[model samples]
Target chain A: MYRYDEFDHAFVQTRVAQFREQVEARLAGQLTEEEFRPLRLMNGLYLQLHAYMLRIAIPYGTLSARQMRQLAFITDRFDRGSAHFTTRQNLQLNWPKLIETPDILAALAEVEMHGIQTSGNCIRNVTSDQYAGVAADEIEDPRPTGELIRQWSTDHPEFSFLPRKFKIAVTGAAMDRAAVAAHDIGIRVVRNDAGEVGYRIYVGGGLGRTPMLARLVREFLPKDDLIAYLEAIMRVYNLFGRRDNKYKARVKILMHEAGTETVKRMVEEEFARLPRAAINVDPAELARIEAYFAPPAYEALGDEPALLAAARQADAGFDAFARANVVAHKQPGYAIVNISLKPIGGAPGDATSAQMRAVADLSERYGFGEIRVTHAQNLVLPDVRQRDLPALYRELLAAGLGDANAGLITDIIACPGMDYCSLATARSIPIAKAIAQRFANPARQQLIGELGIKISGCINACGHHHLGGIGILGLEKGGEESYQITLGGDPGNDAAIGKLLGPGLAGDDVPDAIERIVDLYLAGREAGETFVAAYRRLGHDHFKGALNADRH
Target chain B: MPIVTERGFGPDGWATVADETAVADGGDVIVSWKRFVAEAATLTGRAGRIGVAVGPDFDVDLHVAGLDGVALVAIAFAKFADGRGFSIARRLRDRGFAGTIRAVGPLIAEQAPMAFACGIDEIAIPDDLAARQPESRWLRAVELRAAVSYQRGYRTGASVFDQRSTGGAA
Candidate 1:
C-alpha cells in the first residue's frame, strides 16, 4: 500500500478546507442549490432520494488497515452503520447530512483519503487491477501509473470541467480484471518485443445509456510520454465532445461522431504541439512513484502448507471456501483471499461497520496491514499466507464474511437502485436478492460455474449490467417494473456488450427466468466451459427461448 | 460587468461591438469572430487595438492564421457548466497567441483559479453574478488554489513534481 507523503497530506488537507468553505457558502445561501450541485459533486457528494450520499475514493482500490478502521469509524459516526461499495471500487455512505459532509471529508483527509473527482464531469478516481502487484500474470504493477494519473487529474486546471464525466482504468495483467474496455481511457501496461515497457492505449469506451468498447488509439505509446499523450486526448475531447445533449457527451460519442482516425490525428497534432518536456513527468518522479508499489518482503516458504490441506479435507465449508475464494498469488507461499460481500439474499455490496472493522483486523492479523476493494463489489486480502488461510477463514466465518461465492451466480453486482437512488426507475437490489436466493444452494452454484449476473435499475448502468455474463436491466414498461435480460457480455480481453434477449418480464418472474437460462446453459455447455465461453459457442439463438417459456 | 484579473478587479479596456455594428476609429474595440475574419487586414492597422469575441464552438485552428494583430481573444461560456472556453483558451496559448485571453459569461467565483491557470488573463462576468459573488470570493479562490497543485506546466506556481525535484515544500 502507498503511504501519503507530506505533500500528499497537505494537498488533501487543503482540499478539505476548500470544500468546507464551499459547504458553508451553500448553507448560508450564498450559493444556490444549482450552483452548489457541481461543487458538491466534485467533492463526491450527491443528493440522493432520501439523503446526501458521500462517495469516498479508495484510490486504485487499495487501503491500509488503518484507513479501513477510519472508514468504519466514519460509517458508525455519520452514516447509518453501513456503506455500499460501488462498481468503480469506491465506497458510498447513503445517509450523510449535507451539513456534516465537510466533517466527513476532514475525517477522510486524516486517513490519506478524500472524495475529490469521485464524481462530476472530471477525470474520476483512477482504477486498476485490484490484485495489482500481487497477481501472477502481471508484467508491471499498474498502481504507480494509477497514482500518477490520480495526481495529474486532481483539480487539473485545463480539464476540471470536462464536457462529461470521464473515467480511466489501467491493467498490468493479461486477465483485465479492471474492465479497462468500459472506461473512457484504458491503459494496458505491456512490454514490446524489445523488452521495453510501454502502454497500449484505448480510448472512447464507456457504459451509460449507450455502451461502447474502447478503440485502440495508440498501438504503443512510449512509457515516458504517458502524461503528455493523455493531455492530448483530453484536450481534443474537451474541445469537440458534444455538449448539447448530455446523454451523448462522453468521449465515446466524440470518437463515434468524429471518426477514430480524425480523433487520432487531432490527438497526434496536439501531442506534437504540446510542450512535451514541460508536461511529461520526470523519470525521477516516475521512479519515485514506482518505488511505493515495490513488492513487500516475503519469507521463504512452500506452497499449500500442510495445515491448510488438512483443514480443507476436514471441513467441507472450508473446502468450499478454499475452492471459491482463494486465488493464486505470484509469491508461492501466499494467496489472495477474496472476502465476498455478496451474501445470499443480502444487498450486493453493503458492509456493516462491524464487518469493515473485522476485515481491517483480519488484514493486520493474517497478512500485511493492507486490503483491496474489488471492482466486483468484494474485498480482497492480497497477501494472506497459505498457512494462515484456516485461521482467517474461521474468523471470517464468525464475522459472517465467509461467503464461498466469488464468481458464482450469487456473487451478483447491483446498483443502489430505486431503493436509494433518485435516478432509478425500478428496484435493483431486490432483483439481485431474488436471483441470489434462487441459486442459494452451494451444490447448484458449483454446478453452474462462474456466471456473473449484473442488475441495474436504470439505463445509467451504474451496476455495469452491460458487462455481465447475464445482464438484467430494470425498466418501467406500461407502468410496471419489468426486467430485461441480456447474454454474452464480457469484461475481459474479448470485451463485448451483451445483446438484448427478448421482451421484458415482470419483476416477480425475473428469478425464474434467470433459472431457466441457467438450466439451458447447463444443458448446452460442454465439459468445463464457463457461462460466457459456452454462450460464445452456443450463440445467442440457443438461449433466446429461456425468457419466453410458457411457465404460466 | 466586471473584469476579474489575478489582481482583483480591473477596468475594462475595450468596447465590444456587435456583428452588424460599425467599428469606430479612436478607442480599443472587441468584434465578433465573423467581423474579425471578414476585415482582418483592415483591423490590423486600425487606429485602435482589435479583439475578437469567439463563441464556444469557435475553431481556433481555422482562425489562428488571421489573428496576427489581435490584442485579445475573448472566449464565451454560454453556460457555466459548459467548459469549452477553458480548452479554447489553452488552444490559443498553445498556438502562440501572445495576447490577452479573457473568459466572458456567467462563471462563478470558484472557477477563477481554473480560468487563470488555463491561460486566461482575466474573466468578465455578468453583473448579476458579480453582485452575488463579489471580488473577495474570487481573490480567495485564487489564493487558496495557489497553495498547491499537482498538475505540471500550467500558469500556476511550481507543481508538486517540480517542488519534489528541487527539494522544496509543495
Candidate 2:
C-alpha cells in the first residue's frame, strides 16, 4: 500500500537503466557470462533450466488490485499463463526469456514495481506477516517499518555484495506469522509496558542447510532506532560472517559462533560509537511512513457469527470452510477468509494468473481490495463482512480457491524443489501433490486437523520444512530421491527448530511417513492439542516410535 | 623525490605534463598520502587543477576544500563496478566544488548516465576502451530518477567496527 516516493522512483529508474546496459553488453559479447551472471541476478533475472526467470519484488507483499492485474498480464504475455508466488511473497515467471527481461522490468517499473535485490549474494525481498495490519493481536502494523528497511537495503552500496544472501522478515503479531524466527533478522513488533511500540530483535536465525532458530538480541528496540540498531547488528555480521565457505556465510552461523551475549555486546558498543545523526530516525518521517499503512475502514455491526452460523447450518461446505479457512477479523461483523491456493493434490501456493486476478477482484467485492499471502502459502481476504462470507465462499469455490484447508493437513507448504530451483536435490512438488491426494479426504483432513506438513526438496530448507510440525525434506540417496522427516518444528510465539527423527526415507515412503506421523498425532494428541504441542509433550521419542513402525 | 608519472587528467581525462615546472613539481607530488592533513597550507593550490581521486582512502570534502578553486574531476577510477568514484563525484558536487566532476576510468561506456545520476558531468574512460567504445551513445539513455548514492550502507552502523560512516556529507 506504500506509494512510490521521489527517492524510490529515482532509485529504481537508475537501476533499470543500469541493468539495461548490462544486458545489452552481454548480448553484444562485451561482458562475459561470469560478469553478467551476478549483474543480472542483482536485478532479479536468473537464467534457469528452460528460460530466464524474473523474480519481481512485491515489497513486503503489499500489492493493489491493479498491481495484481499487471502481474496477471505479465504472466499471460511473457510467461506460460501462470506465475509462481514464492514463499518470500514475490512472483517468479518461469519462461521470461533473456530478450524479454528488459521489457518485463519496464512493465514492472510502470506500476512502481521492480525486481531489485530479489537475488544475488545480497539482502533479499523483505517478508512480513500477510495479516500484519489487520491482525487482532498485533502490537503495531509492521509494514511501514518493512518498507523503510526495503528502501535502505535496495542497491545498498556496502552490503549488497555480502558474504551470502540475506533475508529479513517482520511480524506485528505476537504470534510471529512472518516466520521471523527463521530469518537472518526476524523483527517481532512489540509494545513496551509504557505503551510505546518497538521491536523485539532476533538475530542469526535462518533456514538453509544449517537451520538455527534466531536468538533474541534485544527485548525492545525503540521504533525510532530500528534502522540504527539493525545497522549495528549487520556490521557485526558483515565483518565477522564467514567468507571462507559460501555455505557458512550466513549471519546465523556468525551469531552461533559468537553467541547471543557476545553479539549483543558488540552490537550495543558499535551502536553507541555510531554517530547519532547517521542512525537518526526522524519521528516525522516515521509518521509519514505510517500514513501509507493507515488502518482499514471498519464497519460496526451486531453478531455476524450468529447470522453466519445460521447460514452455515444450511450448507455443509460453507460450515466446513468457516470452521477451517475463515478466521475472526479484528473488526466486528468481519472475518478474515483464507482462500486456499492448495487445490486437492495441486502444488502449494501455485496460483494461476487467472486465479490471482480472481482473488484480486474478490478482494474488492467482498473485502477491501487488499489480499494477503500468508507464510502457509494461502491467500487471505483479511476483512470480509460476515454477511458476505457465504457469497464470497461460493465465488471462491467457483474460482477453485475455496479448498477449506487453511491449517489442515492438505494446507501443505512445499518448495519448488527440483522443478524450478537449481539448489534443490530432489523433487518436492510431486511429493506434496501425492500427499495432498492421499489426504484428499475432507473429513479425514478435518479429523487430523491443525497438522503442518512442510516439504523441502533438499536440506536448503526453502520450503521451511524445519518449521513444520511434520517436516519433510527431500534428498537424493544414490540414484533415487529420498526424504527425511522431522517433527515438532514451529514458527510461532514459542519458535523452535524441528528435530530430525532419523535416517532418510525413500521418496515413495515419504507420504507413508507423513501418514504414520498423523496417525500417531490423531491417536495420542490430547483433547484439542495441536501436533506441535503433542510433539512437545511427547518429545522425539514418541515420533521416533511412529517412524520406526513404517518401512519402505 | 619520487617520480610522479601520472596516468589520468583534469576534467577527468588523462593527466599530462604541461611543462618543465610540471615535471619538477610533479615528480615530488606522490599522489599517495597527500591528504590535506599531512601537507601544510599556502603550497596546497600550487598543483594546477590537481585533485586527489576520492576513494575510501581520502575524504572528498576535505581534499576539495584544501585545493580550493582547483577544478577536481571526480575520477571513477574504473568503469566496471569500482563505485567509489561516484561517491567522490557526489561529494564534490554536494560541497559546491564547481570544478568539472568528470568520471575517468576503465569500461566507461554506458556508465555515463549512472555517472551523471551520481552528479558526474564529465567522464574519461581508458584511451583504448574509449577508442573502441562510444561514450556519447550512453548519454542517449538519460535516467529520470537521480539520487547521489555514495554513502548508502546496508546497516546504519555498518562500518568496520559497527560504527556508521554512511552518508558522509548528507
Error of 2 at A531 (Å): 0.4
Question: Which 10 successive residues of model 2 chain A have the least lDDT summed?
Answer: A273-282
Q: Any residue pairs clashing in model 1, and if so which? A: none
What's the fnat for candidate 2, on a 0 to 1 scale?
Answer: 0.04
What TM-score, computed on C-alpha atoms, does each candidate reach? 0.99, 0.82
lDDT of 1 by residue, A14-90 (tens): 88898889888888777888889889999999989998899999989999999999999999999989999999989
TM-score of 2: 0.82
Residue B15 Cα positional deviation in candidate 2, in Å, after optimal superposition = 14
Write model 2 residue lDDT over A437-520, tens digit each, in one string: 999988898888898889998888878999998889988888778788888889887888898898888777777878888887
Q: After superposition, how far is residue B111 of candidate 1 from its true place, in Å?
A: 1.0
Superposed Cα deviation of residue A162, candidate 2 (Å): 1.1
Candidate 2 — number of clashing residue pairs? 6
The parts of candidate 1 lying over 4 Å away from their true place are A550-552
